[model samples]
Target: MITAQKREESLQDVPIAVSAFSGAALERAQIENPQDIQFSIPNAVLVGNDRFTLRGIGNNAISSTADNGTQTFFNGATVALSPQDEFYDLERVEVLRGPQGTLYGRNTTGGAVNVITKRPTSQLEGFAFGQAGNFDSVKLQGAINLPMGERVRQRFAGYWLKRDGYTENLATGNGIDGREQFGVRSTTEVDLPWAVTGRLTLQYFEEDSSRARETKRLCKAIAVLGCSPNELGFDSPNTSAVIMQTLLRSPIFTGIFPPGGDIYAGAPNPQDLRKIAADYDPKTEGENFIGVLDLSKTLGSLTFTSLTSYSEGKSKASTDWDNADLPFRFLRPITYQLGPDRQVTTDRLLTIDQFTSRSRTWSQELRLVSDNDGLFNYTAGAFFFDSKGRSRFEIWHPAIEFFTRAIGLPAASQHVDNDTPYSRTKAWALFGESYFQVTDATKLTVGLRYTDEEKAIRTRSIVLAAPTPYVVAERDWQEWTGKVSLDHRLDLSFTDETLLYASVARGYKGGGLNPGNAVDPDFEPETVMAYEVGAKNQLLGRALQANLAAFYYDYTDLQLGQRIGANAVTANADAKIWGLEGEFLWRPTENWLFDSNLSYLNTEIGEFLTIDAANPAQSLTTRTPAVPVNLAGNELPYAPAFKVKIGGQYSFGVGDWTGTLRADLTWQDEFYAREFNTPNDRIDGWALADLQARLVRDDGRLELQAFVKNVTAEDNIVSSIIEDALIGSYRNVRLLEPRTFGASILVRY
Candidate 1:
C-alpha cells in the first residue's frame, strides 16, 4: 500500500512561491540536520557559518542584531530572529521565498523557514531503535504516540548520537571533531468541543563536542631572507617559519601573500589551525519551549483560525584549538582561561565561550481561509510579535609573547553583549486564484501584501580589560515592505499537477547594527525584485512528478561579510543571482523507484562599497573594490552546483515471510572555494552510498532492517574554514560524517 501523500493543499492552492519536504522523505535519506536537506531540496543553500540564504537573501556573517539579510522561523514563530533555538524534532519544513512580512510578522524581510512539529495523533503506538557503526559511532532513537483518552493526546521522540572525530589532530594523540548529542522533544495536545486545540511542547538538547577546528594560514615565500617561513620556527616557544611553508597543499598561495601576511614576519606558520586533538574541549547546550493555543471554526463562506504561541530558549557554544601564535593584531595573553602572555601548556588553544539568547518570542495570528467555492479562492492573516536576546564572548591568546611576558596586557579579555527590543509589525494581504473557464485549460493567481514595522534596541557591553567599564546604548528604527506576484498554468489538457508559472516577487530584508562595536547609523534593509519562470509536471500514468524553476534575482543592498580594521561590519551591496532548481521522481513498474534533484546557482555581489581585508589573517589584492564588481561569482557554499540521487527497492513474499532491498547513492560535482586562504578548506565532491534491507511479517507484528552510510568511507568537508596549521578542530572545515553501518528492529502487538 502507498500510504504516503504526494501533494498538499498548500502546494495546489497557495499563491505563495514555496516548496516542502515530508518527514518521510527526510527519514528515508537519514537527514539528521537541516544541512542534509541541501542534497534533495533545490535553491536552499547552507553556507560555511551554518547560515542559510534562500534565493540568495542572507549574509554569511551573522551578528547580534537583525541587520542580517536572512531570517528563519519555526512553527510561525521566528527562530533565527535571534539564534536562541536549535534544530530539533520537526514534522514538516516549509521554505517560503520572498517578503512574507505580511504573515510571519518578524524579521522576515527576505522570507521564512517554518518548522512545524507533528501534533499528537489520536493513536497509540511507540518504537525504539539503535544503530552502531565504525569509529565508535552510535545512534539511538525512540518515539511514542499516545492517546490519553478523553481530551488529551501526546507524542514524544528523542535521539542520542555519539561519534569519534572525523579529522586527525596531529598535535594530540586523539582525532578532532569528536561529538555527542542528546535531545528529546515532547508535544501534548488538548482537544475541546466547539473547535479549540491547546498544544504544549518542550524540546531540550545537550550537545558536547569539540567544534570549530582552527585553520592553517599560508605565507608568501617571497625569499629565504627575512619574511620567509624560516623567520618563524616550529620548536618550543615556536617553530621556524621557513620549513613550515613546505606543508602547504598548494604552493601557489605563497605568491599572493599580501602585506597582512607580513604580520607573521619571522614566525614559522603564522597561520592559526584546527586539528584532531584530545581536550576536555568546548561544550554547547540549548533548549526550547513552544506553547500554542489554536481555535478554528467554519461558517457558511469563511473558515477562521486563531493561533497564539510563546517560545523561549537559552544556549551556550564554545570551541578550542592549538594557538601558540597570535591570531589577531592585538596580541592578548593566551591561557586555559587566559594567562597574561605565555604558552599555557594546556590540551587545546583557548577555552573560550559564549552565553546568549534566541527563542524569547510570543506571537498571535488570526487567519481566514475562504470557504466559498465560487471562481476564486483566498486567505488572509494578521500577526504580531516581540522578543529580547543577549550574547557573550571571551577570547585569549596564550602564545602571544607580549602576553606570556605579561608586559602591559591584561589576562583574558571578554565582552558580553545584547540586543533587546520591542516591535510592532503589521501586514495586510489578499490573494485570489481561479481556474479560467474560458480556456478551461488554464489557472491564474494574483496576490499582494503590504507590511509596516517599528523596531528598537538597547545595547549592553561588558569589557573586563577596559578601564571605562561597561558601555550601554540604545537605538530605534522602522520600515515598510510590499510584494506582488502572479502565476499561470498551461496544462489544462494534461494534469492539474502539471502547470507552468512565471512570477515576479519583491522581497524585503530589514537591517540593523553590527552589535560588537558598531558606530554607523545602521545597515539598510535589502530589497529584491525577482523574476522566475517554472514548470510542474507528471509523466507515465501519474507515477512520476517533477518541478523546475529558474530565477533571476536583482538585489539592492546585498549583504556581504568583511573585516574592516578590528571591527566586523555588514553593509548593503548591489548584486544579482541567477539559478535553476528541479526535482523528479519515477516509480515505474510498481516494484522499482527512481528519484533525482538538480540545482545550479551563480551568485555574486556586483558593487561592494569597499574591500577591507583587515581581519589579521587575509588581505584581498585590491583595497575595497567597487560595489557590484563580482567577488568570485562562485556557486554559493553549502549549495553544490549539481546533485543526483538514484535508488530502487523491491519487495516480495516467500510463504509467510516478506523481504525488501533498497539502495541509494548521492553524487555531486567537485566544489572548491573561489580563493584558497586556509587549509582543510576545500573539497572535491564525492558520492555517498547507502543500502537497506528489511524483513517484515504481514500481520504488522514484527519488522527488522539494516542500513549503512558513506559505505565508501569518503572523507569530505561540507563547510569551509580559514584554518592555521597549529591548532586543532579550528581548521574551519566542518567534516561530513565518515562511513558507518547499523541495523534496526521494530515490534507491534
Candidate 2:
C-alpha cells in the first residue's frame, strides 16, 4: 500500500517532459520494448534499430562514433553499447525527453531511455506462467520467494522463450529464423536490527536465436528475361579508382556486375545470382549478467541509503542473406572472374562476423534524506560510476570481384578482412534534489548534479591487400554535464491532488574514434539545454487524474558522423538540432481511459565543414551530405505526429467465476522519415485496435488471459527514404505484424 504523501509527490516534480510505465502496466500492454508495434505514447516513433526521437530528436548512424540518439539505463546502471540486445528484466521504463544533461548525463542532447528492475519483496508467495502462440512461439516465466531467516529472505526467478524464425518459406524448405532464450535472477535480503537493512541480487540472461543481425535481399537475377549479366548484377567492378573519382571529378565509374550476375552461384551451381540469394544463413546469440546491493539506515536526523551495482555482457552473431550482392558504388567496384561464375562473380559476397561486443559497468551511489520536518521533505546524494565497452568490425572484398571495378584500377579497395578492437570510457559524479514546502499545500523542487568523465578508445586493424596491409589506431577523451527543476503544489479547497512545475537542465553524449585514415581522435561532445512546464492533478470529483507537460530543447555542436579519405575512414562534424515535445494522460471513469501526445522539431547544421579538412577531404561539396538538413527541422526521426488512445474494460463477478473483457484503440498522425536525406522518408499516421479477456477465481488471485496485437495489418511504411549512391536499403520496409493470439495462466499461493 502507498501513502497519500507518496502519491501526492512525483519521483521528480520538475517541468521536464517524462513518463514512467510500471511493471504491471508493461505486462498488461504485452510490450517487450519500444520496438513494439505501438508508437503513440509521448508522440514518439520507434524503429527496429532502436532509433527513437521521443519528440523527434534522435536518429541512427552508420558511424560507430555517432551519438546513439538515446542512452539506456538498466537498474540505474547506464548502458552505452549496441542497444538492440539490451532488453530484459525490466520492472519499469522511464522515457525522459529533451535534454537531460544535468541528471542523466551526456549523449542525451536528445533524451534518455531508462529501465528499472523490480526488487524482492518480503513475502513467501510466488507465481508461475506458461504461454504459447503463433509462429511456434512459446514462453514460460516464474517467480519464487524463499525465507532465509526471521530477519532475512530470498527471491528467485527465471524465464524461457523459444520461437521459429520470422523470415521465410525457404526454397530449400527449412525454417530460416528460429530462436531460444533462458534467464535467471536471484535476490537475498538481510534485515539488520540496527535500523539498517542490506540486500543483494545476482542475475544472468543467455539466449541463442536462429536470427542473424543482417537481412538478405530476396530478389535474384535469374536471366529468365534475356537479362544481361551486367544488367542483372555482374561486371564486378573494382572500387579503388571509383571512390577516387567520386569526389575528384575523375572518369571513374561504379555499379558494373560480373558477366553472369551480381553474386556467384556456388559449386556446381556455377556462380549464379539465384544461389547467392538462397544461401543466406541466419543465427544470433546474447549473454548478460547483473549484480546489485542496497543498504539503508536511519542515523540521528538523517536517513542514509546506499546502492551498489555491477554488470557484464557479451554478444556475437552471423547473417547469410546475400549481402554480397550490394550495389557496386557502395562497394567501390573493379573486379574479374579468376574462376567460374559461382567461383567468384562479385566481391559483394560477405562472410560477415555479423557483429560482436562486450561491456562492463560498476557504480556506487549514497543518498541522505532529511528528517521530515512536518512542513517539508528533501533528499541529496553522491554518485560514482565506471564503464567499458569493446567491439569488432569486419568487411570483405574480392580481388577480381566487381566491387573492385575488376581489381586492375590503382590499389585494391574491396574484399577487406578487417577488425576493430574495444573502446573504453569511465565517469564519476555527485547529485542532489530537495523540495521545500512553502505553504500548507504549496511545494518547490530544486535539483543539481556535477559529473567528471574520462574515456579511452583502443582499436587494431589488419589490411587484406598485398605488401604491408595492416595498421592499428588508439585514443581517449572526456567531459562533464549537469541539471535543475522546480515544482509547485496547488492550494485547492475541493481536491488537494495537484501540482504545477517547470525546469531547465543540460545534457551530454560522449565522443568516439574510428579506424579510417582521417580518424579524428578529438571528437567533440554533443550538448543540449532543456526547458519544460507541466500540470499534475485530479479532477471530476476524483474520478479522473491527468499529467500534462510541454518542453523545448536546443542542441548544439551536434556530432556528425562523416567518411574521410581514400581509406574510407570516419570522423565527427558539427551540427545543430532543436525541438518541442509534449504528452498527456487522463482517466475519466472506472471503466474508461484516454491519453495523447505530440511533438515538433527543427534541426540544421550551423556550418558544414568536414572534420578532416585536409587528407581525402578534397571536395567539401561532394561530402556535404543532407544528414544535418535531412534530419533537422523535420519532426525528430522517431517523433510521430500527434497520438491518442482510448481503452475500456468491464468486469463482473458471478458465482465461482469472474471475467473481464477489454478493448483498446490507438491512433497516430503521420510522422518523419525512416531513412536519412531522402525525399520520401515520410509515413502517414495509422490506427489499430486490440482485445483482451481475463477469467478469474472469485478471490481474483488466480486468472487466465487472452490477447491479440495489431489486429489490422496496416500496409504502411513506418518511414521511407532512398539510400543514395547505393542500391541497398533503398526503401526500408517496416510493417506492423499481422495478428497473433496468446494466453497466460497465473496463480497465487
The C-alpha TM-scores of every prediction are 0.77, 0.78
Whole-model lDDT values for every prediction: 0.52, 0.54
lDDT per residue as tens, model 1, 1-749: 11011113645344444666666566555665765655555555555535665654555444455544456655554444223223345577676655554345334544566677777878888667666766687877778889999789999988888877655544445555566767777888887677666676666666566543332222233332212221222221222232222222123323322323333333234232333232334446655565666666667777776767666666666554333232223123223334223345433234343444554667666777664556665666665556556555444433332232333434323222222332222223332222332244444544444444444444443322332333343344344444444555555555536666676666666555554454554566667777777777766677887777787878787555554322355665676677787777777776666777767766665634344231222222224433332344434334445656666677778667688787877776555432222222245676878788877888856777787877787765555543222221122345556666777676553
Q: Could you give candidate 2's per-residue lDDT for residues 150-268 as a string of tens digits? A: 88888888788887755452434445446687778887888888878888877787878765443322122222211111121232222222232222222232243332232333212
Model 1 residue 736 lDDT score:
55
**What value does the lDDT take at residue 156 in candidate 2?**
82
Candidate 1, superposed: residue stretches over 4 Å from native = 1-19, 67-71, 80-91, 96-111, 168-172, 211-280, 321-359, 399-443, 454-485, 488-497, 515-519, 612-640, 654-658, 670-683, 723-731
Candidate number achieving the greatest lDDT relative to the actual structure: 2
* Deviation (Å) of 251 in candidate 2: 21
**lDDT of prediction 1:** 0.52
